[model samples]
Target chain A: MQIYLPIAEMAIPAESIFFVSLFVGCLSGLFGIGGGFLTTPFMIFMGVPPAVAVGTQPCQIAANGLSGMLAHLRKGHVDVKMGAVMLLGSSVGTVIGVFVFKLLKYLGQIDFAISMLYTILLSSIGLLMLYESVSKLLRKKQSVKLEFNQFKVNDFVATLPFKMRFPKSKLYISALLPIGVGFMSGILASILGIGGGFMIVPAMIYIIGMPGIVVAGTSLFQIVFTTSFATLMHAVTNNTVDILLAVILICGGVVGAQIGAVLSRRIKTTHARVLLAVLILSVAVRLSMQVFMMPDELFSTVVR
Target chain B: MRIFLVVLMVLLSAPVMAQSAVTVDLAQESIDITTGFNGADLKLFGVRDAPGRIAVVITGPQREMVVRRKQRIFGVWANLSGIKFDNVPVYYDFALEQVDGDEESEDVEARAALNIVLAQSGIGLEALHFETEENVGPDDLKVFQGALIRNKQAEGRFPEAAADITFMSDTFFKTSFYIPADVPTGEYQIKTYLIGKTSVKDVSTTNVRVGQVGFSAEIYGFAKENGLWYGLVCVMFAIFMGWLSDFIRRRL
Candidate 1:
């Protein structure tokens, strides 16, 4: 059935919103990732304005992150100190991001900016996942062992000022490192409307030298805060958040995540990664076609 | 009862008959956009005492609008440049009264004559005007203006082809116009033109009020007026939903 969204000022099929969130939520639960990379673009394709889609996403992501954070917290894997420091950086980053977003909206380039950013981000991330999963599959067939030794704390990251100790991760790192990393993801989260856990989790383990066990928990911990803060900022500054849209998406997403979390136990991780890679890549390709292909109507009009 | 009501309306406004040859009234004077309002079809029936032909035009709620052209920038189509126009109607629709002709009209010449009359009286699309201080050349303005009309037509805000103002009887002519759900809420004019051979003989304008009410209005009003509280409530709602879902999952 069609439902009118007040702030977006449009009527769309309620099931379409629910199903998109459900699919993305399932993927996020199956893989330990925030699927905003998929959800935001899907909404845009479904005729939600880029600003509304981006603005409304944070609350849904915040809610999804909370569930995951709770699970991780129970396992005692969250390094709250590290997550807090990163959140500090992200808060500043989100402010800058929202400013840029508003500027782009005024210039009427928000659509292009969102589309372009998604194309670049989704493609690289999808390709990386595809490559890693394929090689791992091939290696298993040949029984070749993969090495676990990853990043060394480079002298530059080690020597930066304001070193802080995170007892949970058992690491001493420069406070600036997590802050800078958090800041980058925060900008991305605000602009792209993704929880940014996929990006932030990797950065936590590789860049900040956090323990792998704590990385997911810490990333989820910070995502809840950053997304909540970003939602507030966009709602206040841009007035773009569609609360009704968020409600439908969150309702579908949370349930889907629960089901996905249950199904993840039975499914092989490698195959699922490959499937997800394909999905992400397909979205990127479609976005590229939308941008590069000649439109049937070359002129678009916007009401001011 | 409906026809009787239509006649009664004409008789009530008969006192102004000497001042103008035409008088028009809508089925509804005001429309409330309650929750789930899609769009509204307005029944406007009129009387034109001295008319070679009759036409109805509806316009309202002027707004600033921009028509942007797409250009390939870095191999991607982006909205590059735009012509901003002032005083553009957010809603525009018009229809001509079909001359006494065959009901199933294969009468091309008769329709052509009607078009000629509409064009001459400036009662149709080509006569619509918009102003801009953007220092644009006439050709660029024409292109953007045509684009604007085309877009609006596609959106059903403007009639692509003239719909007929059908006559119910010798004295009463009625036509239906749709006000789209997305039409900006404001004052609108429902004008019935008494088209003479080459000019408008008499014009009668009626007022229409479209306003948003109910849940949709409440939500939008709250969001715009109290952004901070709305945002906080949205966050809280989402968090609670998340927590509830997780709680349900564990119990299951």
Candidate 2:
């Protein structure tokens, strides 16, 4: 059935909207990510309009992040101090990003900019993940217990001033590092209309040298706040947030996520990563094609 | 003495014009758009003393629209140029009906039958163009305007073919058209034009209000005004929904 979206000012099939979110939510459940990168593009392709898709996606991400954070909180996997530090930087980034989004939208270049960003971001991440997972899978089975320096503040990192100790992470590093990482991810999240889960997960794991056990939880913790901030900013400034669309998506999303979580246990880690990589690459390719291909109708009309 | 002359001039012109007296009415004057609104169909009923041709045009409220034409730049399709048109109808639908099954000979008869005044009139969509104001590049405004109408027409917002007006009796005629659900909510004017031989004999316009009425209107209003609070509510609602779904999942 079709339903009218007030903010988007269009009628869309509710089932297609629900099923798209469901698919993305399933991916999120399987990959331990917010699935914004997938959902935003898919919504645009489904003719939700680029601005509405970008503005409303953060609501979905925030909900997914909060749910994930709660689950992690139960397991005590979140590094509250680290998450808080990153949250500070990310919040500022989100404000700047939303402003940029507004500027691009005013200039009528938002759709082009979004497609370009997706192509670049998805391609890099998909290739890197695919390479890493493939190499790991081919390395055979060795539980090589290497000496862990995940929490160790290296001499160079420790001397950078403003050293803060994260008791949960068990590290003393320059506060600027996590803040900077958070800020980058925040900008990315707002501009790209994503949860920044994929970027944040790797950043926390590799850059901050946080333990893998807490990476998902801490990343989700920061994501919840950053996405929430982005959502509000888009709403107040652009008025693109469609509450009905978000509700329908979230309803399908949460259920799909649960199903995906159950299904993930049956798949191997490398296989799942490979599948995600292929999915990401395919979407990236499709988006790039849209930019390069000649459109049937060269003109786009919008009523003011 | 001036009034007597004016009345005498009107009486003298009445027989010379020989125009038809027409009256038009819509089934519903107001359309209520609630959450249950999908689309609606309106029956346009009318009475005419003279029988020749009946044409109905329903046009929605006018608004400014920007039409952007993309160009291949730097190996990518980008919106490099655009033009803005003011006072363009957001929705336009028209129906034309010919009576008496005189389709082939009406053109010949229309030319040879009566003393029809040569007025500036015809069923041409191009004539719908109003004053244009440029907002962007030095491109032809007509091109963009035509593109706008073409695009809207393709989307079913612009009527492709006019419905046939069927006469129920010698004096009564009616026609109907389906309004798509995506039609923008606003005031619409249903114009009924009575045509004779070569010129428009008489024209009547009726107003129809199409506005969001209940829950949808309230939400739309809230979002438009209290955007920040609406955003907050949306986020909170999403969170609540997520939690509820998780709760249900656990139980299942």
Candidate 3:
């Protein structure tokens, strides 16, 4: 039996898709996630073709990110300088990543590579984050002091010749770090067809030692361009972008972002980090299972 | 005097009646067509609307073609739906023999059959079977058939009192038609038609042609084949690496 999805196709009934987007958007804003992790999988589950699913997720990211960024901007959480530098690097990296992506497709190993990589990455991140959060809680119960010792200056980053002062982050780091981060994020965005906000936010916070507020803001800033380029490139070349699906996801994500921003104000930083850690670990576990466990149906084809 | 005046008026009106016949001129005879990596733009000329049907015939290279319906509402243009056709190479002699000896009386019938066959061969109709249409509002339109598209409009309606039609499918297949890089090009004709209740209402045609070679085609072509998995894998890897670096940094 064929079922009609009126919300995605019909303008009048699009609110259904919008509501779903809103929910995802809120989570993206609250957790400082790109929501691509959730949205793309959800789209696939909804019977959308893989190509369309990947292509449309970015438009949703752009919309949700815009709203989330606006809220962060008002809170003075954005580091414009850091974001600008990162944007430059990401732009260059994304273009190169696109080329590499094409090569992989021509080779026909893209699906296996993507699945293997995602499984490994998500599971590892999830496990580590979960371990850290649990440990932190246990230590807090035992009356251990949580000092800011992680803020110590690194010689590798600090010794780089071109040092630039980040007034907002209150750090003096080499331009190389941001550029490197941008390059990595850009390649990821291009290859995975995602906004890369999930990776960028964590990098900013843990590696660059930017405050959580700035990390989230900067990540969103970079995501806008990264995903925009991906969207345009996909539309012109792959013709995979389903504008109908995009509209549905974006409407939902935007509303969700607004609610998420409001809820974020109430959550403590430590708790937020812990939640993020747990989320990452859970995704990681799921990915690892796919790699290690043989399927009941051995002949089952993996959806691209 | 009245009788003489009536006679004079009759003689003068006979010449005006002779000049009332309509004449149509198709500006360009043939066209070279090309398709984008994801989509293609098509145009044909010398279209005429009769009582119950609209017809377009072109004599050119063996190629594929898609016929679309377009509508204009509130000064905006939009595609309504489209049909695809395939053209097979045929000599004039073969075509004439296929029509049989009653050439004059069966001209219209023969033309219709040729058009249908060309359309069926060139443009695959698989996508058309699953097409869907949704009216969002004043300016939004969406059309889809599983993995194919008939037409889509976002901000405005079609400019004519007609529906804009577009044809595209998800299947990745190669075609025989190729636009040469160094061919001398001139204006070509694009034929469009409108189907109305009980009859074909209006027929229109436009001129379009390929010009100098540009980078868009190359860029678009490369992207179509590789963009999907590349974007997906790279982003996932970045997330993994970022977290790994963080974990290592903390451990040290």
Q: Among these predicted structures, which one has the highest lDDT?
A: 1
Each prediction's RMSD over C-alphas, in Å, is 3.1, 6.8, 17.6
Give the DockQ-based CAPRI class for model 2. Answer: acceptable
Tell how far residue B142 is off in model 2, in angstroms.
Answer: 2.9
Docking class of 1: medium
For B1-252, candidate 2 gives per-residue lDDT tens digits of: 543453344344444545536776667667777666778887677776675677788888998887788899999999898777787788887777754545566567564542232224424464476456555343577678778877888777887766678877766677776777777888998888877776787888889998877778888999999998998899788778666755665675
Model 3 spans with C-alpha error above 4 angstroms: A1-22, A132-152, A211-213, A261-291, A295-304, B1-252
Interface Cα RMSD for all candidates?
1.4, 1.8, 19.1
Per-residue lDDT tens digits for candidate 3, residues B213-240, read 2333332344456565534443343333
Candidate 1 structure quality by residue, lDDT tens digits, A103-147: 988887888888888899999998988887888777745322213
Best TM-score goes to which candidate? Answer: 1
- DockQ in order: 0.65, 0.47, 0.02
Name the TM-score of candidate 3. 0.49
Winner on lDDT between 2 and 3 is: 2
- Sorted on lDDT, best first, the list reads 1, 2, 3
Native A-B contacts reproduced, model 1? 0.66
RMSD of 3: 17.6
Per residue, candidate 1 scores C-alpha lDDT tens digits across B1-252 of 765687687867766676778887777778667557777888887776765678888887889988889998877899999988897888888887766564667877766665676666556788788788899988999999999999888877778877788887776778988877666778988878887655667878898998777888898899999999999999999788867876776786
Error of 3 at A223 (Å): 2.0
User: Residue B196 in model 1: shift from native, Å?
Assistant: 1.4
**Residue A222 lDDT, candidate 2, scale 0-100:** 86
